[model samples]
Target chain A: MTSNDKIIEIEVLRYRPEQDEKPFLQSFKVPFTDDQSVLQGVQYIKDYLDGSLSFRWSCRMAICGSCGMMINGVPKLSCKTFLREYYPGKITLEALKHFPIEKDLIIDLSDFINKLESIKPYIIPAAPRTLEQGEYLQTPRQLDRIAQFSSCINCMLCYAACPQYGLKPDYLGPAAITLLHRYNEDNRDAAKAERMQLLNAHEGVWGCTLVGYCSDVCPKDVDPAAAINRNKLNSTMDYFLRFVAPRGGN
Target chain B: MSKRSNEPIVWSLFGAGGVVVAHTMPVLIFVTGIAVPLGLVSADVLAYERLAGLADGWFGKLFLLVIISLPLWQSAHRIFLSLHDFGITGGETFFRVVFYGAALWGTLLPLFLLVGM
Candidate 1:
């Protein structure tokens, strides 16, 4: 360690099912540089301080979305957050909120995964097109409609930020519904009517209270709140139009 | 498929009332509450006979009814949802009846008064 390297205290919330009855904060003082990220600091802890510490991370960059945690009570990608910002103050690292922690700083994502699968994330083609018929064509404007909603990395930060999901676990949370909207908005998709049924339910878009923190905490600026609200309009129209039109204006 | 929520009916009202409130409430408050009381404009601008004449017209009655009634619906919808946020999960039907019933009452009472006038 160089003389210029500053020491920062990182308190990680630890839970081992066989060993500990409950999760507890374990502090470690680590030497770090201004250039290093919070993820690197935790890496240093694992390398030298405690090998028993567990967390999930694939890419040191933010693209992988695996290193999300509660840093000072805010959901953030630890890889993108610099240690220099919290240099003088102690940093608390905990598993993402509104999820069951699997181990230290690692959350069980089964529920989120199940919700993801239920949304039918892939496009169900408007019509069957054979290889001889050629690929589906979309205009720039058509792609733009669904592009923003497609940026979600499945980091679950928005899920951590959502109070509604925290209250009602079954409420098809932010990222999943946002992805559902993404597919629905795509011009080549034919299953809008099929998908709209999920959104029409009380557990669907109606579950969102427009807390909007989901948009605020998003690393990619996905704006899940806007997607959900837009679908609310669609859902509302569907509710009334179903009585008049045969397909409910789908 | 899960049963659909009846929220869209009230949510449409909430959305409409939100627009009306956003567009008109500030102007209404400024004109009636602030400017008229402060005499920034002439007091006769809101004289009772003149106001009564405005209410007597069909268009004016419709306008008054919309301004008064829609906001009550908006507030009722908001308060109803806020009950969930505040963690009061029981007696959903009771709360819905009380809140929406009050907004309905607000709507009809104005219609009757404006027509009776």
Candidate 2:
């Protein structure tokens, strides 16, 4: 019950871009306290043992959405994984999966960023209006419909848990689809047709095999699976009703 | 996710066929059911008897084998997938060992039992 009992072995996956063709594991013995987080341990390692260690981190808390990595083969935020929870043990740390690794825990999020940009992330009104039209009003139920998905911080942990994304990087991924769901269900927004174009494409919604891991691994409870699946339903209706509905519906 | 999502009409057909085999095969196996949807869904999806039929001269037995194995494969894959999503995994190596072994039995068990040698 004191300051003396502090010893934990940590394994870190390493890659030196110039020297190594691929990545490998490196181990360190860190002195950890009961309250220490995995990110704290990583900080200790980088600060003391090796400045060469690479990983992404911004908010020491889970909010910045930047610090997602794999701990023991499952995607997690280093800021959140407590050392006490995994006590008297060896911890394995690796880069988030399903993304191209730039070095260590850092991955090229260009794919995910591009996906977000393509979905018309903002609201498109049903014909832009002036103050004379008044602000489009919405009921409580309408706000609740798209509210859950809007909590996404874009951490990309869902992509890390998803094997389909790893197997096919072209897949639109969970976060972007969740964003699309946000706008799709927003009563004030009228851009379903624009979002539908991206959702209905070959590399879009169809790529999901419904493995359902994305939702399971999601920290925000955004339920990207439900959003993506619902979008598919939306697209299917749009496809079949193309003749009957307004041609420029979006 | 969407109700309007593209339902793979072909897979749905396979699923229906497998469900039929799943229900009927147990009755056929014992040849005494009053009438129902009875056999094991997992066994039918695997199509283990398909291999048995390839080995045996009996056409009826062969047909049953093919029909039953489909349900077995479909069910097992779905089961493992559910396990994975639940995060109840023993890790990747553990999953590979368990699933690959199950797949082997999925293909070979019926043939070994039905065709002899």
Candidate 3:
């Protein structure tokens, strides 16, 4: 409302399944200050401009991994991206790529969720340790091995950035594979053989052509590309070792 | 149990070829294209008789074979995968045959030529 406050145009891709034949861009001019984020801008539109505008957001600080959208065609957390950066120009917002849009700026994450579940994200402990044995202890070195991959916040930015996943929807994409690697690297976990089955398949690590955009767009610095590449080596060894070793060297 | 991919067999070749290309290709290019052509290194270093002699030896034949063949495999794998990226998803088996078959021929032709030499 201040005299110096600037008004910026936000073109949002809107889809109302009941009414619209297809998604369309609807623009809104909003007044914003330098410190306000894209999320805040969208919120302002929802609160004042249009009540029915829909989007998912929480934490407003990029931790929840929601609020992901294509801002100028790049997958980004709207909460972390400040409006000031895209000031003086129009910003086009759309749902994340390679996902089915549920509504305006909201994507159906069931595919990603199913992929996450299929990876067996939790460690299947080597042996059932009794409470008397206490917590599963890990050395710093052991933790270090899986720590980077463990930082993934389940943000689908990597999936949006992955061309392979975009091309082949069944490709087991970045975040899920990275999470699978995290559990495989855990010293206390002995279910690598079980998990490696998923990775050994064509839909697994073999699907990745190492485009590496997944690592580049990762908000948490979880290099899913590196994780996938490392697993490729592991999978290759497993593939050949099966013929020589009784247990396939799992 | 998920069906395992045979990509590992081809990927192993690709990985090995990539390593060989990364480590030696630059040196090979510089030696032949730059150093010898520019006369920075002696032309005699790559003289025809000496070159043939090197190719005739077991170690040199192995080196030459690796230098020539591995890169073909590497390029074949990369081109094959790139076809997927280019949105050519159909006839994967045909494309695989075309790309990897050429690499196979490249490997065999050199082996036969080197042994005859």
Candidate 4:
């Protein structure tokens, strides 16, 4: 174990909306402990060394889902990634990929939220259930089918890895679509037909070029790429079988 | 151009074809082709006895034909997609050509083998 007195070489992406026209990288050396996270290292610079540097974070423990950034060219939550991983080496920190820089590490995630809204992101039953019957029943196997898809904390790491979303802004990126699937698979939810109508659009599942990076970068192993791909298969089958079975979208 | 990932259609076809080629063609040579009949003796019996038994009869021929043809079509389809991802845009006609070619020969092989003189 090395002392915390050592300075770690950090090259961070810097952008000033009020000053600079575009984003660029700036290097700084900050002394940090092995126990400290990259977020702590950034805080050290912001608090003592350079107040001009800006990034977003809260909870400092990785739960807030607010501190995702491109660390060493990979999108990760700064609060979770250990500084010891890059000890004695130069690391380049940048804003999350695929979104325009709002300032330093901040990105315009408004578009992402809008896509989230597009899916309705809630349960809508085909018919209202009576109070006597209680909630819809689902088996463990059914839950397993979509439970792994539900662990996403919306860190947007998957979006940063998806080249398809970067190339096409209109494409509904991984995180939001994964949320859509969360509700779509719920047995208590009867809106598969309605949801499928929205999800089958161009900006929906079809927009995915299947770059597969979304699954790779996902911290929760939600496999949004697989979700979208499987949904595509389902939607296509449902559409083709529509004539044979008039109510087949679900 | 954007890179496509391990979509099942592309990968499964490619993989199954590679496996079949590695496992099947060599057996055909020692057991039935110019090697076995001419006593070239350049093959393994235990390595292929079970598989050879299956391929000896009509049912086996049918199974082999189905497996081999499907993988070829799949490989062709995957290769086309791989080409598209690499930004080699020769147009959709290339796909149509493969489709029609697959349609033409994909069925013809079974028809030829099953109903041959």
Best by lDDT: 3
TM-score of chain B of each: 0.93, 0.44, 0.94, 0.48
Give the range of the ten consecutive residues with the poorest summed lDDT in model 4 chain B: B1-10
Candidate 2 TM-score versus the reference: 0.69
lDDT: the better of candidates 1 and 4: 1
Locate the minimum summed-lDDT window of 10 residues in model 2 chain B: B1-10
What would the DockQ be for model 4?
A: 0.11
Candidate 2 at residue A207, lDDT?
65
lDDT of 1 by residue, A59-148 (tens): 888888999999999999999999999979999999999999899899999999998998899989967999999999999999999999
Error of 1 at A40 (Å): 1.1
Q: What tens digits encode model 2's per-residue C-alpha lDDT throughout A74-190? A: 898899888777768799999888788898778989989988998878889888878998888899999999999998989999999887777667778888989988998999898
Model 1, which residues run further than 4 Å from truth? none
Q: After superposing candidate 3, which stretches have Cα over 4 Å from the reference?
A: none
RMSD in angstroms, candidate 4?
Answer: 5.8
lDDT of each: 0.93, 0.76, 0.94, 0.75
List per-candidate RMSD values in Å.
Answer: 1.3, 10.5, 1.0, 5.8
The best-first sequence of candidates by DockQ reads: 3, 1, 4, 2
lDDT of prediction 2: 0.76
> What C-alpha RMSD does candidate 3 show over the true interface residues after superposing them?
1.4
The deviation in Å at residue A232 for candidate 2 is: 2.4
Note the residue pairs that clash in candidate 1.
Answer: none
Higher-TM-score candidate of 1 and 3: 3
